[model samples]
Target chain A: MNKNSLKILEKNRDPFRSVKLTVGITISIIFIFPIIWMMFVSVKPDGFMTTNPVEWFTPPYTFSNYVDLIMNSLILRWLWNSLIVAVITTILTLVITSLAAFAISQMKFRFKNTIFIFFLLGLMIPGEATIIPLYEIVKSLNMIDSYAGLILPMIASPLGVIILKSFFDGVPREVIESAIMDGCSYLKLFYKIVLPLAKPAMAAIGIFTFIGSWNNFLWPYLSILSETLYTLPVGLPVFNSTYSQAYVQPMTANAIASIPVIVAFLIFEKQIVKGISFTGIKG
Target chain B: MNSKKKAWMQDLRALPFLLPFFIAYLIFTIFPIFKGLEMSLYEWNLVRKLEFVGLENYTEMFQDEFFWDSLWNTTLFVILTTPTMVALALVLALLANLNTKLQTFFRGSFFLPSILSVAVISFLAIFMLQPYNGLVNTVLQLVGINAEPFWMADKTLAWVTIVVVTLWWTVGFNMVLFLAGLQDIPESLYEASEIDGATRWEQFRYITLPQLIPIGRVILLLQILASYKVFAQILLITGGGPGGATRPLIQYIYEVGFTKNNLGYAATMSYALFFILLVLSIIQLRSQRSEGK
Candidate 1:
């Protein structure tokens, strides 16, 4: 939106600017169309969706689907499960990764390179590859169907550690040394000094972890046999699947599941984009 | 001052810092990995008594036609999706990068689907692509296609539907990467080319295409691994349906393991999946090296 940024490109002054706008609008519509259509359908009553599909906005909208979804299923409990897992995962990831990152990047630790490389190994290992063994491990430890089963494994995100480590490394060494000279303990230095300065980095990592945890479905779906333990993503689909007749309630469930994530993205759009690009470009 | 003893204590500080993640990494990732490998060598589901049958599972993998079928399905998916996503991502990135006031809105809207969970997107897409009563088919009918397409039911079209859904759900991330790459191309280069009377196309060819290639390769490599790993969306959308028409390898593995209780065989399939990804990882590393970054 900055005029200054626009001034740098010669095409900004060209007559083709309108062409760009039209094309941009078209593509934007395509990208957001699914969610918009889902929301549109969510509010409409049964049999009205395909009748006048084009007139998506002109609605005698109802909250029937939402009411049906809530009344029929353990949706509120599912949402609660999602919230606890997401929040606890975020807190645990931040606490653990921040400390490890500090040591890996900031301190003169033994086998530092080896430790960092060990974490890097995780980057290549996909969740699908590990889930088979992890299932058995969790089962053996009697953590299955517990929040710990979900939260504990998710805490050791290698990317979070690397992101924070790189951020911490950029902090001047003198900043830490000066704090140490002032009789700061190592733990105090982490909480009171390094962490505060790394707020943007922390926010980025936190949002990423929270979003990842919130949206996680496969592991939760596989491990949680009981309806009481279902997270939103895992629970919503099963709820949706049984509604083979009308899509209204299903769309409502999806819309509700999607809202928090979209809201989070909207609130931290810049940081989220920066965090993603950071993972790509500088990862 | 006890500085010598203090220095030793200070050096030990890193241990406490590193403990939590290391402990977690050990249990979740490291332990599961070895367990998966070890269990793959056994002839045991969770219920049965364990029998050490090394490489029997491996041989069964080679002999099982379902394994080959699923692998082919996976390869087909990767082929169908990766290039289309890469090219589409580039085009979208270019359009969004156009010097305009609506750039931020365009970027955010385009990236919106990437924020939603795959489960949400898959169900929403199913709603969109749902046969004669679906929005897409309704539009097709309005436009004069008499025989309405069964997007998820027909075999070939099911693949197309899955690919289209994948593109919609994920192309945003790739666009963001490419956009980052595009912006990194100095405006000064374009400006200089314009001064030398280079046409817009010429400027794009000389400056834009070359600069975008490295980023494109990296994104391509990523999309290959990611596309092959597609599961949740496909699982929900088609349920690998129309009689296993849309079943990718991962779904097959999941079904074999849990539904049929063939954990050993499933783990064997998982190892095969891991090997394929490992090869892709090597190619990614090689491409990065070639990019000389």
Candidate 2:
């Protein structure tokens, strides 16, 4: 490397580094603005959010919105409903999917490939296409306005089984074979060996299920008619409309509703990223 | 007989774990899909008797202007948003992958919006796009671009607002996927490119893009399909209003089915959307496979 060449390299690298830094910082701010704004509005006093030439961050920040939301709104009810539905759905989905994936991946059951293909075909059918019929079924079952209606339908996720099945297939066959040679039953093998080995993939699937169930709008919106039974996403809109006069309070309600999923993501960021990446890879 | 009994018992043991999903699918998914097909052929309100009016609903759907408009709007949205969101996600992922001090913070910040429900985001968007007192208009005025148009009022601007909001909410997830893809790409490739005196652009074009293609295709397909089914944001933000400017097929279907009690017609419209998505996904998958080959 000559002196002139080194100088040119340094110049090029400096500009490249600076451009990268600028772009990175700009994008970070753009992405973070909405959530930060939501939090800001939540703490701001009523009528302050809508002021002309809007104050980005006004003084005399009030925790009254949060206090008001807690005392007045059906937030706790909605959060409890969301939690029950989300948690049950996640656990049920993991169990069913892991078993189905194991069967499809390891067991040579009759029509195994055919059943697997059937599930894959299910992936192509948009939920909107079947929603009307689902409504009818829910009505017929007299399950409307119940958590059973909300959670039961979502328990069967084709994407979950497909992703987990692929992950399970990557588990070395020798481990299974050795377990079988020791007179281990299929159930015992799955519980003792497969479940533990597939923990990362299971965590990924669980996170996906939880986030999806938490954010689900259309299903709960259509099914749950009772205000008392509404989940956060469904309930927040109705709450906002009902309390339209109090702008900051609903904003506070909205912030409170989003906290669980946001906190969940922050804690299990790795699992969330892994789950999203898995979806991208398999799709 | 003992061996056969043992085999049957093992199958029974596996049954408990698999039962929930199968039962859920059979009742909620498979049965409803078939019922939806059946419902499309009938003329009945929730309380009224079903009359066999085969194909009438489908015929009526073709002449429906709202259906056509919604379809067009949805198609336009899918076309506009999918590529831009995927590209932006890829760029963000690349930037995040670079060795820097604020990598984790930047990644976390970008992902923050995705955790909120669409309803909350749309409400905030309504505030931000307020014509007089909104932050966006204020920013535009500061930049000397006075006479900033109302984003959610005009038809075209409404569509643009929906797309931008959707992108902001979704790009983080796709970016995380791309980041994972980038991490999977061996560090030795970049080192080798540097050794060969390859410029960053050349290295990205050759190594990064090629490695990211499979992940890219997945993101593209998911975005296309998901965007086609957008309803919540549209409902919350536009309500398919300002003269139905932002109405998508799903929202239209919801209105027809629940609001108007036109289940038969809504079924027909949903079927049409189903067919369009089916065709597009097949084409996308075929093209992707051929490209890989």
Best by TM-score: 1
TM-score for each model: 0.93, 0.92
All models: lDDT?
0.83, 0.81
Candidate 2 per-residue lDDT over residues A10-111, each given as its tens digit: 446654777887989998898878777778878988666453444766666888888877887799899999999999999988988888888888775455
Error of 2 at B260 (Å): 0.6
lDDT of 2 by residue, B1-293 (tens): 69778777666765665666678777877887788888899985664437989999988998988889999988888999988998899888878876667888778887878878877888888767877667788878877788978887798888888989988887888898889889889867866777788887787899989998887877788788778888899898888877998788899999898889977777778788878777767766676567662
Give the lowest summed-lDDT range of ten residues in model 2 chain A.
Answer: A2-11
Q: Count the backbone clashes (under 3 Å) in each candidate.
A: 0, 0
Error of 2 at A65 (Å): 1.4
Model 1: share of native contacts present?
0.61
Where is model 1 chain A poorest over a 10-residue stretch in terms of lDDT? A1-10
lDDT of 1 by residue, A1-283 (tens): 3446546556544656677678889889988888888888889886565544677667689888778777877887888899999999999999999999988887775578998999988877777766877788898888889899989988888878877888898889898999989999888988998999999888777877777788787789878888899998888788778886577878888888887778877887888887777667311
